[model samples]
Target: MTAIATVTHVDLATVQDGGRRGLAGIGVPISGAWHRSRYLVATNLVRGAEDPRQPAVELLAGSMELHFHLPTTVAVVGPAQVTVDGLPFGAGVGLAVTADVRVVVDHRGPGPVYLAIAGWEAPLVLGSAATDTFSGIAGTSLRSGVALTGVAGSGCSAGAFLRQGDDAGGPLRVVPCEDVPLPVGPWRVQSTARSGTRMVGGAASSSGSRPSRPVVVGAIQAAPSGELIILGPDGGLTGGYPIVGVVCSADLPRVSELEPGEEISLQPMDVPAAMQAFAVAERERRVVHPGVLGRDGSRRGSVPDDVAPAK
Candidate 1:
C-alpha cells in the first residue's frame, strides 16, 4: 500500500518467494529461489525468521540499484558487493536504510545473490510470487524504474550471517542408479539457466530412445551426445533423456552455484548419507548472533568474509 523503494536498475532480477507447490502435477514448474539456503538466510536477516511466504528480490545476473522512498532495512545474501548511499556493507548483514538512500548490488560472479527487505511484498500469483523464466507462469522479470511497495516492518532482529562454503568445488554428491551409469569425466559446465544446466566433457553412453517420464529438480539426464544436464528449479515437469542419477538434495544448492567451465565429478551417496547431509545443512542455517546492526545504522562485528566493512 505504501511505496518503499523503486528499482533504478536491474538485470534479470525477480520477486521470488517459495515456488508454487502442489501444482506441478498440473504441468507447472516449481520455480522459486535458485538457492534455497541463500534464500532462507536472506529471509531471516530482515524479518528475523525464515518465512518463505515473504518475497525477496532474486538477482541472477548483472547488477541492481534501488532508491528507497521510506525508511526500512535490507539484507543481501550470497556473493555480491552491496553499497548503501555509497557506503559498502557486506552480504548477509542487515542495513538500516532511510528515504532518499540508494542501495546497489553488484554481481561478483558464480552464484546468484538475494536481497531481503523488512516487509517486502509482491503481488501473489496462485499462492506464490516466484517467476518462472521458462514458463512465465507466476511472475515476470524485474526491469528498471519499477516501483516496489511494501508495508515496512517496525524493525529487524539479530540474525545469522553465514560465511559461504566451498560447495561449488569438489565432487557433487548423488544418489546413483545401478541401471544407468552416469557418464564419466569431470564434466565441464557449459551454461546454466532456470530450466537446467548443460555440461560438456563426458562420454556418451547411448541410452537410445525411451518414453518420457516424470522428472524432478536435481535430476541428471544424459543425452546421446554424452553431454549431461542437471535440472534446475524451473526444469520441465517431465523428461525423456535417460536419468543417470539424481543429485543429492544436500548438494543441489552447490549445483546452482557451479559456474561455466568448472569441471566436476559425481560422488555416489547412499540415501542415509544424503539425508544426514541435508539435516546438517539445516542445522547450520539456524545459528544466529545476538545482534546484526549497531545503533549508528552500521553492521555489527559479526560480518561474513564476503561482505565488505561499512565505510
Candidate 2:
C-alpha cells in the first residue's frame, strides 16, 4: 500500500463574503500545491443559515485556506471561505493540488460549519459519494479536524472535478427516478417563493413551469401540482407519491448542474429507448475524456439519443 499522510493543520475560520460560493451560498476555498496526499481535515463548524439542512462543508465559498498532502482535486458544492498558506484565494472556484496546501473557511453568514478533505476511502453503496447523513450508513456530519474518507478506487488525481463552471448558471434537467413512468422533457426551476421550504435530505420541492403532470416511471411517482420532488442517488428505497415520470440515470449529472431560476426542457422517452440512449451517451462521454472512463463506461448527464420527445 502507498504511504498515507496525516493532516498537519485544521481551522474553523469564519466565512466572509465572496469566497468559493455555491448555490444557496455555500462553499470553500483551496490553496497551495500539495501532492501524494489524502484527507480533508475539518477543524471548524461551518454553517449556512440560508440552507441549514444542506450546510456548506467540504465545498468552499470565501477567503478560506486548506492544506493538502498530495496531488488532489477539490469540488465546491456550497459556499465557503478559503486560503492557501495564509494567503487569500477566489471564491466559488475549484482547485487542483500538487503539494502541501492550507485552507481557511471564514464564516460570513449563519450556516452549518464543516470542512471536507479529499483522498480518503469510504464504502460505496450507491452511485454517489455523499454520506447518508440521516441513515448514518456511508457518511456522517463533519466536525473540527474531522477526517472523512473518500471513495475508494476513485483515482481522481488531476482533472476538473466541477461539472459546471464557477459562475456558469443554467436550467436543471429532470427525467424522473425509478418511480415515474414517462420520459419527461426538461423543465425550468426557481428558488422557493417563500422561505421554510424544507429540503428533506436534499429533496427540494420543484416549482415554476414544470413538465407535464402525472409522470410515471416504474416505481417512482409524482403529483400534478404543488411541488415535484425528484429523488437523488441518496433518496430512500421506496416512497408514497405517484411517480409520474423518471429521470434517466444517465441524466442525473445534468440535474446537478442546474441552478435556481433556470429553465429545463424534458423530452419523453420509453424504457427500451431510454436504456439505448444511456448506452450511446456513455460511449460519447468516454470519447470526450478517456481518463475518467470507468469499467461500466456509463454516462451521467443529459438524455440518451434514442429517447425522443413525446409527440
Candidate 3:
C-alpha cells in the first residue's frame, strides 16, 4: 500500500473512474469523467486497470502539489504542463515517480487533468470509488494534507502520446440534430458549478417542445435561460433542456481541454467523418485498456477554473 500526501491549499482533486452505472434509472446522475478520452489515456498510461479496483485522480482545474511516499508510475492526460521537483515531466506518458519528489500540475488546458496511480486503493461507493459531489458521496475532496493510498507499480513503458484531432485547429466538430437550430460560430465558456459539464454562452434558447428530463451525455440542449448547456461524462442523465445538437462523440474529449472564456467553435461533421473521429480516439484508448471504463456517476463538482497561469 502507498499513500500520496495532498500538499495543496484547497480541495481540488477527486478519485474518479468509469462512474457507477445501472443506477441512473433510479434517479442517479451518470457521473464519470467529463472527458472519457483523457480518462482512458491517463489511466492506461499508468497501466491502471479499468476494473472497479483502480481509480485515478481527476483534476478539474488549477494547480496540484503532491508528495509521493513510494515509487510508482503516474501520468497526466491533456494539455496540462507537469513537472516533478521543478523539472519538466511529460504529460501523456507514464513516468516513475519516487518517494518525496514533488509532482506539480500546471493545468492551463481545456479539460480536467487525470492523475492515474499504478493500482487501485480507494474505497467504493455504490460499487464505485468515484467522488460525486452532487450525491455527497465523497468523504471529502482531495484536500491539502490528506494522504492517498495505492499499490505502486512500474507503470507502462516510457513513451509520450498525443491528443487526437489537433490538426483541425480550435473548433469542436459537431453534427446538428433534426429539428434543432445549431448554434454557429465561436462560443465563450461561462462559469458553471455543476460537476463534469461547463456552460456555454447564451447564444440560443427556446421553450421548445422538449422534456426537461432524461438528457444524455454530449446532448447539447437549450436551457430555460435561453442558454445552451453541453453535458459531460458526469452530466445529468435527465434534464428539462431541449436537445438541439450533439457534439460528435470523438470531439467530447477535446471539449474537456477547453479553457474558461476561451473562444470555441463547433464545426459541422457528418456521420462518416464523425465515426472516423470516434475511431481515432478509440484507437488511442486501446493502447492501454482492454475495454472501456464504466460510465456511471463519476461527477465532478465546480472546481475553480480561474487559476492564473504560473509566473
Candidate 4:
C-alpha cells in the first residue's frame, strides 16, 4: 500500500480577515481541523496526478499570488519575478500542471497571488471537492499555512489543457420533478441571481420568486406537456418532486461532455425501453472505453492508453 504525502504549509497574508474567518469556520466544522499547508508556485506550471499515492503541490515563486476557494477556493502566494531554470514564467496566462513535473510560477507584480492545497479524496459528500460557497458546509477558501494530507489523483490526461477566455458551454440535463409540470421542447435554463441554494432530494432551491425544483437526468412522463430534467451527481437522494422523466443512464457521458449554454433535446421513453437502452449503452461504453474498468472490475484512476478519446 502507498502512503499519501501530507501538505506541510499554506500562506494567507493576501486574503482579507473576513475571508479567513469564513474559511476557518466552515473548514473546522466539517473537516474537524485544518490539515495542509500551501505555497505559491513561481512558475506557470501546475501538476495534477503523478501517481495515485503522491499529493500534487503548486510551487509559486516570489511576487505571485493565488486566489482559490476550497470546498470553495485554495490560494497560494510567493515572491515576484522568479525564474524556473533561469527561464521566465507566469507572464499573464498560467500554465497547467502535468504529472511528474515540477515547474515554477513567478510574478513581477508587487502584490502576491494566492495558492491553496488540500487533500483530494473521492466520494465527496457533494459532487465536488469544493465546498458550497453559499451553504457554509465546507471551507469557502484556502488560507496560508494550513496543513493538508491525502490528496488524490485528478485523473486528467497528460498535456491536457484549459485556456483562459475559452468557454466550455452547454445545457445541464435534468429530470422533471414528480410534482412539477413538465415543460415542452428544449427549455432554457434561467440563471438564479442568488447563491447558496440548498438541495433537497435531488432538487435545488432558488432565491427567485418561483419555487426551486429538483433536477434529475431522465425523460419526461408521457403527459400533455413533454418536459425533462437531467440530474447531476449532486442531486438529492430522495424528494417529493415527481420524476416523470429521466435521462437514460447511457446518455450520461454524452451529457457530461456538453459545454455550458449548449442545448440537448429529449426523446421520451417508457421505463422498460429506458432500461433496455441503458443496458445497451453500458455495454457499448465498456467496449469503447475498456480502460474505464480495471481487471478486477473496479474503476481505474488513470485511463488506459488503449482507450480512444471521445469523438
lDDT of each: 0.79, 0.33, 0.64, 0.30
- lDDT score, candidate 4: 0.30
Question: Per-residue lDDT for 145-169 in model 3, tens only?
Answer: 8777756554554323434333426
* Order of models, best lDDT first: 1, 3, 2, 4
* Candidate RMSDs in order: 3.1, 14.4, 9.1, 13.9
Off by over 4 Å in 3: 1-11, 48-53, 154-157, 164-170, 192-205, 270-272, 284-311
- Which regions of candidate 1 fall more than 4 Å away from where they truly are? 158-160, 287-290, 293-311
Off by over 4 Å in 4: 1-100, 103-148, 151-184, 191-231, 235-244, 253-260, 285-306, 309-311
Q: Which stretches of candidate 2 lie above 4 Å from their native place?
A: 1-65, 69-99, 103-119, 122-130, 148-220, 286-311
Which pairs clash in the backbone of model 1?
A: 90-307
Candidate 3 overall lDDT versus native: 0.64
Per-residue CA lDDT of candidate 2, range 1-311, in tens?
A: 22112334333322111111131111111111010010111211111111112212332123334445554444332334455566553332334445566655564422222333334442332322344322444332333444434432333331112212222233222344443334333444543111111112223233233433332212233433534455433233444555545656445433433445555455556667667856765443211111232223333344344421110
lDDT of 2: 0.33
- Candidate 1 lDDT: 0.79
Each prediction's TM-score against the native? 0.91, 0.44, 0.79, 0.35
